[model samples]
Target: MTGDTQSWRRAAPASPVTLDDVARRAGVSLATASRALGEHPHVAAATRARVREAAEALDYVASPEAARLAGGPTGRVAVLVPHPSRWFFGELIEGLEAALRAADLDLVLFRVGGPEERAAFFDRLPARRKVDAVVVLAVAVDDAEHARLASLGVDVVVAGGRVAPYPSVGIDDHGAGRQAMDHLLHLGHRRIGLIAVDDDARASAWRTALADAGIEPEDELATTVAWGGEGGAEGMARLLGLRTPPTAVFAHDDETALGAIRTLRRAGLRVPEDLSVIGVDDHPLAALTDLTTVAQPVREQGRRAGELVAAALRGDLQEPLAEVLPTRLVLRGTTSPPGAPR
Candidate 1:
């Protein structure tokens, strides 16, 4: 019971649906019937339709667990994430909850995962035994770790970043990163700086995006660590202390952006005059702070992930599919041309 654990476990069967019964009526292979019901990628549309037609004729019904045995399903799903405190997490939870509720299944939530705890999670195969699948949100894990998840036979879907052998759902982080940097560049910010999380996967992607944009050629790229505010403030302080300090800054997230803004103001700098700033995430605070940002479709991402999970649960789709949501630019008071004399 790690992430989003909910009620309705071991509930009495809602109705009974038999794969064998469907297969026999459809005159397809039993395995084909399973794939058709699960909507797996390899199964042909024609065969799937024929199988569904057979199933409808039989008035088939099934328990979640039973269907998983014959298809790619489990009665419960686990939503694994880092950083339990944030508006983003809340939005993600809403989508996951809605999906599970509709399917009459359970959702488990696990947060603040470490190597040992993660190992325990895999060993338990909770997602396989107690849940049908898992959704990982903006959390960092390696290819090896993802392989471990695959070995456990739990359907996995990631909402941020990417993992091997697992279909993912996310907006283009690189495009998002470029958008952030491009905003600063457009404002005539040659001395732009970055405040990023210390995640290898995410870090590499963001940095590459900045490089490709031809904004910061080499020494201009300064790296600093922060997943949220405190780290962001420290990073900003360091950047500001440089002899040729950046005139504009982009924090990886809203919290980090706010931190940079705070650090600059404390150093007797006038925002948008002495300093221009931007960040991703139009967190509620962004409007309050008047910070310009690129807003990802957060709740919408959650809703889509939820719907995808639900589709797999309801035998509507086969195998996990990757999805890309969009991001929007929200202009506010924080950004301006660098060194616009106040």
Candidate 2:
């Protein structure tokens, strides 16, 4: 029986119903039916209804090209990332691609990392004729850019930050900062150092969270460094040289935290003993390093952003679309009560 089933499964199925058949059934031109299927705004409501009914009866599914011919979507989404090579952006792109693939759509990646690239890309509106939606990663842009993005007539989904009038998906950086501060406060750390990166918003959030916790972070203790381990090491080295060096450090991301740990180890200091460390993102390396940190759903954020794009395309987004995921502190070997025995 299994062998017979296998042979049957190998047989080809019938060809899909085409737009011509739908048009014929609806008593309209192929172009009209295509326009109706695309849901072109110019198509009259009555004609669109008739054509859609015909398509349903015929089970007609329009191909990507057919849909575009009718002024519909191109079945492609453009993902804009600040730094494609960075670990965080890489993880996000992976999740976005996975979700897009599941929906039978295509992904087009655009790296607009620096100011020049970003300005050039936006000015050209390269996605205008290329994609149906745009997913912008963690990058700051002014109101004009956001408005220009919307004017391109493509659905925009902002991931990792909020741009009004467009759906956004990300964890609250300020809230996550508060959680990190809360964890460290309970651990009895007074002077905390921050190994921050290029994200000014997140840096400000961390500072605000600290202040709200009644812990005024010292200006000299917080240093803006490069992204990743190298930058983290440099920031830690500077922090360690301070007259009143911090007993604990909170890095912006896990890579930064790992780098800080490397610096401390080389300086003959022990983690959670001489100086505890905590970071955000719970990066892949965080577990290996046993780093105590706040973990947000990076991949999930991307997936949800993709889902939002799909929803907007289907006209399923009747309300303002926004998804703020939660983050939690993952306690590990890197953090402990200050002055506690190792």
CA lDDT, every model vs. true structure: 0.71, 0.80
Flag regions of model 1 displaced more than 4 Å: 1-74, 126-128, 140-148, 199-216
How do the residues 23-132 of candidate 1 rate in per-residue lDDT, one tens digit apiece? 77876544457657776554567778888899888788755653664555346678887765777888777776776677665778877456776677666663445566
Question: Of the candidates shown, which would achieve the greatest lDDT relative to the real structure?
Answer: 2
TM-score of each: 0.75, 0.78
* Maximum-TM-score candidate: 2
Task: Provide the lowest-lDDT 10-residue window in model 2.
Answer: 311-320
Give per-model CA RMSD: 12.0, 15.2
lDDT of 2 by residue, 1-342 (tens): 998999888885777888778877876555456656877553567777888999999877778767555576567888888888887888888888888888777998888988888887788774445676788898777887876674455567888777776678988887887788778877888788888886565677667767877887689988999888999999999999999999888888899888989999999998888999999998888898799989999988888888876665554453556789999989999988888786
Give me the runs in candidate 2 sitting further than 4 Å from their true place: 1-70, 126-128, 198-201
Total clashes, candidate 2? 0
- Clash number for every model? 16, 0
